[model samples]
Target: MLHIKNITYRVAGRTLLEETSLHIPVGHKIGLIGRNGTGKSTLLKLITGEIHPEGGSIRLQNGAKLGVLPQEAPSGPESLLETVLDADIERKNLLNEAETAEDPQRIAEIYTRLADINSHTAESRAAKILTGLGFDFEAQQRPCSSYSGGWRTRVALAATLFAEPDLLLLDEPSNYLDLEATLWLENFLRNYPRTLVMVSHDRNLLNNVIETIVHLDQLKLVKYNGNYDFFEKTRAEKLALDAAMAKKQDTQRKHLQSFVDRFRAKASKARQAQSRVKMLEKMKPIASAMEEYSVNFSFPSPAPLSSPIVTMENCEVGYEATKPILKRLNLRLDMEDRIALLGPNGNGKSTFAKLLAGKLRAETGQFAKSGKLKIGFFGQHTLDDLHPEDTAYQHLVERMGNGREAVVRSKLGQFGFSKDKSDVAVKKLSGGEKARLIFCLLSIDAPHLLILDEPTNHLDVDAREALIQGLNEFEGAVILISHDPHLVALVADSLWLVSGGTVTTYDGDIDDYKKQVIDQARNGGSGNSPSAVSEEKQPNSGKARGNSKEARKARAEARALLAPKKKAVQKLEKQIQSLQQEIEKLEIKLADPTTYEKGADYQASVSTEIGRLKAEQEQTEENWLIALEELEELENS
Candidate 1:
């Protein structure tokens, strides 16, 4: 329940939002998206009152609490769990008062409030959020100061989730997360009971967790009633129609002007020419849709090399000689291989990348690469290595050997840099532009192999798409490490798991990996029963010994007691299915071009019906999840 009316904000002599109004309904999940440097983050700050808008107003529902991820990571001495529990100030204050209250009435009121807030289960809830965010139980008990800034930032995110404010604001919550933690967060936010507005470049997250999209384009906020894909399709169709209408209007105007031009000089046709001029003056101009400049990346194709470009045998890699982070990493890379590395953060993915990039040598074992192979490595940390005062041209010049200035400028042009942009200092460029410059520098020689470590971290949705295309077009070996599932799914043909101090071929898709990660989180990290390298799982000895007469009897009784809950869940599932079918039919109607050709009233009614059905479907899904959780609790008890 947030309302932003005619808000105008400006910074650094540039307008980011100009009289743009947006309304977020209660209990709705919205994704705020735009190109990079378009002020998605700035809008979030305006809503949180971190920065005041120059005009208009922003208002939230009275007494509604707001939650935002902390700008700075925690550096205090508090334990991670304590820091998260402290987020619920009401619960903390009430529990403290309960322990010291002398009056019987006051004690009773305090306990009542604690129960209302479920304060007894607060610690477990906080731990669950922390675990989903990639902290184990033991780590949760450690002091926040013991962790790095990135890990501490995760603790701050956990606190925000534990607080469960009425309105939550997240700005690229998955920027620091791996694929596993990103999936967990997507599931968590889908079931969040309050209102949420997130700014993100991750398309999969926006499509999965969000019900609505609010796009910031041309200094305006435009709302669409669907996920990111739906928004894209709908916007494209609208623009096509606008272009067609503009064309037709332009043809009519030209004809009218031609009549006046040819006849206004003749005395006989003067009267008719004057009438035509009036007609032309009265015609209102129809604005055509202007095309925005799209960013493109072109990776030069390298000369074909022999197969098995790289081979590693029993390789151990780490910073310390005695402590190897990745052990027995036996792997091979062919000239045509496109491999995606999958695992959680701090699980040796980056270390493995460094090993391939020649940054680190094998401590013990044979690691070989083709003598003539040239590798282009793009590490996430390399973004910081850029000289702030150097221009893109200068950065390229330093690494471009004795290449001519014309040749260097041409290379920059392939990465979307214009003459003006190439001369701008690195500090003046946006994140995406800087990333493009990195690409230019790395690919200058057209290396035989490419090792990209989190290359999409600074890219927006469009820029990511461009990168996927560029990677596909490049004829060289690739090893990718990224959190963007959509990009990985498109570019990678093989999956490798770098987990549990080893590397292995993962014979499954991203979906399987997602389920494994979720299962592990749900079962306290003991759900690694799935085969790490193969789809077939080994037989469990415990399950074989678990079968007994008494166990069967207890299970039967538990099932009997849980039948009502199961029935409620099934009934809601059927209702949801029915509503989904109805919504699909309405969506199909809306997608047809003929629908928009109808009167505005008719289209409006159709859209209104779809919205109503979707709202009901959301409610049914929530009820089903609650019933399922209750059934699980009963079974566990």
Candidate 2:
């Protein structure tokens, strides 16, 4: 539904996109991906007309609606639900006019449009979108100013989704969400019935939610009719074939040049030498894929120590002595542990990580670690802790404790920083570059334990893969808290549950944890405790309770009883659609004067047909409503 043709955009004397063209068809869910600073977000802005491209055009289908998150977070006195509902401008305007519309014909038109759009369900739909984004019912009723900036941004996202425009644009939507909400959004996008164009770096999201991959490579746009994994495989094959062809052409050119060089001296071979020269001049070289610069995260292996380097028995940790965020944390960390903490945000996962990193003391109970233990901790706030005016070189020199300048520069270079980048101030660096600097700082000493909290928030997919490799190769105990499920699955060999003001050992893998998170979100925040995980594993639990023959028979009987009601609803819906088409055609004929010119009889017959079709339509609609109500009651029962 959207078309971009030969668009060229430049920023700050750097060309990000050069004569790139892309066409997104109706109902296609596209994922726009590229390396960091490759102008993915800039392309979205070009489509939205926020900024005009230097060359070519962008166009959308006529009358098609567009939805995008606002640049700024919503604020002021509006309630969250009201903000979301107001996104559907048509519904809001029609409903407001229905209250004061005095003309009978106008009232009928307004009500008919309302029914067609199912305006009655608007509130529930808004609430569902808000809840999927992690807003509870009470939170939905609160004023927008009551929330933090991040939460306010989520409300803007909720409003955009509730609008359900013909074409939707999302940019790194999952960055603001936790794993639980991310899963919910993934499921929601999988079922979205309209066109979508999203820019994301999360691999799992691209693989699960997108149907097409539109890659920005080599300053141009390339389209692939598959998901990210499929695109990767196809691009690899293409690159190999191109390389092979280029090599063959080079060999042929060399052979032709040798022939010309050797035969041009002889009069008899002049004709053959000229022919070879012509062939060599006509042959053109093929362009192979260029290798991209990759980031390296080679963490130093820590010195070996005995098992169980750290232990916590009935520990309680928090900022306040009286109000502990996490309590009774009976846990242990051996020298070779690779544990991933699982829970929603605001559930004390970070508190528990801080406790392990020696940043917080146990308010109660016993907590002990080896006397010689060293910890390299990376918290979410670590990036903010850097001095903006300090260069990467200065920061390293300060942290490394009077190390040699060459040694410090070499360390920075190992993490993908060049001499110029190392000299740049931290304030001017991009998010990914800042993250690389943090990794470089954290891995200098290679402590006995590593505690990383959401370390992949700014890293791209390739850099994250590098991190996954680095973490697996590191020989220190690790405690990771991250939203990226792929990294967690590949790196963590064990799972730890942090919820309900305590920490415990989870008995399932990452997949099981994902299913649990989705289930809890869909079920209105129920069954999210540690016990829920155990209950899910038990036989005859949840919806499978009472798996006896009697139970099976009763379930079958209920299904049989409700089958006709569903069929009736479906049949009437089809009939209504057919009848509406017929009515429109007949009304078009009645509007023409030619029918009256034929005779009064012909005109009367046409009018009679129109009346009969209207009667049938009204009756069928009533029947459909009844059937739908009955079906809803049966399903709820």
Candidate 3:
């Protein structure tokens, strides 16, 4: 067991934790959660002894070993497999000593230590971890310097997991993982036989792996004995009860004050008034919970489009004058299409999304789209393109040429930027803030199609939920490439498998894909033959396979069931568009200088009308999401 008693930590004169005590039992899986700046990472650092507390003690077993994933990847010349194996310090030291030991006794002692540390299986264990994290046999043998920063972080995570310490601390372990790898990691952590503490924003991971939640609020730690979902519900109830109790206290205080005010001037009630004053002084104050800003914005509805928004016929997509990563692709996207591209890392999911978004040219075959098609593409490096010197307001103003400043500010506010936050330079913004700004820019001028590559990379849980809501309400085709299973499962109506230099529609859902990955890993990672897997498991095989009359009839029936849902989604989209237009018109009126120059009553009326219009718009968007979700469920089913 680990015991933290009366510990306090301060940074730059700001107190993060004040005299907090926590006891984590042995082998407990705990999730540390809070807002982005609430010192979740700092707590992990304190546990790892990277930093020290200002007061109190953190106690653990005498011989306890800790394994922590480094925030930055270690620089070295070691190969990926070698880097992981090197995490076993005892094994490494023993081997080193045995190489130079002159005495037989010393050699025997070194060998004994090596066996105790299970050094014989270290290489194979490292290799399995690397493979599970999307590294192939060839890539695992390559030098660590050959990989990118994101891949390097994954390598560090692999090493940490392979270390197998008595205590493990992981901070956002799934940040750089693909879906298949994330699923594998989830299974690995579930069976981890040690005290584990992880900080993550992935809801699926928290729900599946954690048994307790440690919520850091107001410089204190509050423990909840449940998973993430249970914590959410319990926290909501607690907050509600606190609010009610505070209201009751306020009511009693007001009544006492009224009595004191009425009789304090009279000699007869002077003693009673003095007593009431003492009672008021003795009352404990109830602090209100901090208010968190929420993001509530929707993508502007795209222009009308008919069926077949985009089409590809025997298309080959790759870099210019190079071999294509995906080939012989035949796909069509309609206005109602919601497809998620699934595959291992470097297996061409992003290549396919880029091809659909027109970011890449087809090297062979024909790729065509409607003449009115407009695409909104969001790549992983989109944040890097942001100008550090520019403010969020300036970026929006530049995109909306000649637009009014008030309207731009209003749009920023909807994306969770306050008036002051809108003026700050982009460089000063956090990663989650930057991601929200990118989403704001992407949706400013809505397109008929959206192609997103790892859209949730830096977003927190709140922002991710907002993105899911927006995508559900979006009235356009979407081709999403993401590792977030929660978001994919909620929004994707179809799955497209991109592997082995080809692209085809997958006939199963995300759960089925996860099961296949786990099975493959357990079987030593050999079941990646896409064609064979699709032929054996896919209910509706691709066009390359011959179709029977029964298959044709089944396809027709599925289309027939989907047609009504599509119409319903279209109807909701039109309603949302109409409401949004009304809200924008009201906002424009409120922004006018002349309107404010009128009487105070007139300005007040304008503000009230704008608020009412915004409320209506919010409700309409909710309706839109419901319609879209129902449609997705029907299609996926």
Candidate 4:
């Protein structure tokens, strides 16, 4: 167990977290969530002991261990496996010492120490976890330098999981993972024996992975017992209630002040007025000080289309002329197709999209575009479509050639481009700002076919949801190439699964598509290991629990089979109770039916009702037996 007691944190002379106290119980899977710049990462660093808090203590039990996924990596082309194993060099050293203890007495002491250290067994478990996390056979030998920044972080993540510490701290862990890897991490975190805490923006991941959410707000910490969805609903209600209370308090405060002002000079009424004033002064101010600033974004609509938006025939594309990323691909895009290109990073998704958008010519085939197909492409990096030389204002103006410059400037302003920032060169923009600008550009005219490449790359979960909403509402066609599976699932109508210099089309949910792909990978097919594609173990794709359709249908069928049986059994039990009551009444009257007034008539009526009940019960019992048999048969089958 670890306790973060009365902590204060300051950065750049500004208080970040003030007098924050949190108790992390042993074996809890906690999630640290908050808006950007709210110190989620900073708090993680504090717990990891990377930085000392400005005040208070992070207390851990004696001999307790802590692990964190390093926010940044050391310079290296280190092999991925070697890098992961380095987290426990001390344990490795202990193993080495135990291996060579020479004197008999020393060896005995070494054996005991080794036995104690054996409980941690980080190295062995790390290897197993790395394997489960989708580390390919070669990952053990691959140098860390050969991997991308995301994969390098994955290497660090795998090592952290391997470290087998008492506490696991992850910050925005889903940032670089593909769906498959994220799913794996979710399952592992759920099953992890150690305490768990992480910061993430992924809604589904947060909902399923953690039991509690802690938020940092206005230099104060607030904790919620439920997941992100619960937090949102409860927080909204709390804020509304707070606002109402604050309004009432304001009204009372004004009334007290007005009375004091009107009567301060009146000798008879001065004491009563002053007493009211004191009550006003003593009243606690309400939550009127909380900010209402919301994150807002909107993109321009594109022009209408005529017909035959885009076409591709025998298209061949590749970075190298002969080494084709994709070859002999036949594809068609009409006014209604919303296509998502699916593949690993090295595959030809970007290359194929570029060909369709007319940014590049197909190396060995022909393609055509009919109608007024104005392509709005959001590339992987904002810099790809942005010009460093032009300001945000000028960029929009230049792109919208005939449009009035004033009108263009106002549109840019709508996207949070204003003041000196409107004049700043595009090169200096932040990732999210750049993404917004790209979105704005793409929105103009509602192009018939929108070709987006990693449109969600720099977007936060909230902004990504906005983009998805806009796309869903567009009525226009889309061809997007992205590695972010959440975006793919949200916007993609169908998948063009490309791999190993070939392409196959699949029609289904992104979740199902990924399941088949992972199953293929697990069975040793063309799909690269999820670990090799991105960092962080995949979150639960929700497929590993079982095939979705099969599980759903099985549950439904079970209920269907059991329903009639259950109804029949209930009817039989009610009839049995009624029959017992009637039999007792008849037995009581049997000895003196004539003595009681109208006793014979009452007995006949009761017998008739009881006979009908018994017949109906027999019929229901027969049906119940048949239904139960069928239910059992279905369950067995």
* TM-scores vs. true structure, each candidate: 0.80, 0.79, 0.83, 0.72
Instruction: Give the CA lDDT, 0 to 100, for residue 267 in model 4.
Output: 99
Stretch of 10 with least lDDT, candidate 1: 541-550
Order of the predicted models by TM-score, top scorer first: 3, 1, 2, 4
Name the lDDT of candidate 3: 0.84
Show the lowest summed lDDT stretch of 10 residues, model 3.
543-552
For model 1, state the Cα shift of residue 249 in Å. Answer: 3.6
How much lDDT does each candidate structure score?
Answer: 0.86, 0.85, 0.84, 0.69
- Candidate 3, RMSD to the unseen true structure: 6.7
- Residue lDDT tens for model 3, 1-637: 6888888999988899999988999999999988766788899888888899999888876799999987679567889999998888888888888889999988888888888878888898889898888887988889999898988998999999999989899988988888888888998999999989999889998999999999988888899999999998998888888889889999999999999999999999999999998999999988674446778656877878898988889988889767888899998998877788888777888788777777788988989999989888888889999999999999999999958999999889878999999999999888778888988888888888889898887777778888887887677778898888999877787778888889887766676677778888888894253333465565554443343323434544665576567777778788778877887887788788888788899988878887887788788788889988988887678
Residue 333 displacement in candidate 3 (angstroms): 1.0
Model 4 lDDT tens row, 1-637 = 8888889999888788999898878988787776555677788888878899989899887788888877686348666666677677566676687788788988787667767767356555656555545566666577777777766767788888877788888876765655556666766777788888888767767787888888788787788998888887888888899889998888988888999999989999999998997898799887663553333444333455655676667877776546767786877776556677766555566777777777777678777787567777776654566887787777777778858877887777656566577788778776666777877776665566788876665655566666776665455678887656677766665567666676666534566556655565445543252221221233454453235335434544554455455555656666666766765666566446473666667767756766776676577667667766765776567
The 10-residue segment with the lowest total lDDT in model 2: 540-549
Clashes of 4: 29
Residue 390 Cα positional deviation in candidate 4, in Å, after optimal superposition: 9.2
What's the residue-level lDDT of 127 in candidate 3?
92
Question: What is the Cα-based TM-score of model 4?
Answer: 0.72
- Mind giving the per-residue lDDT tens digits that candidate 1 earns over 285-378? 7655764555677776677678799999999999963589999979999876778899888888999999999998889899999988999999
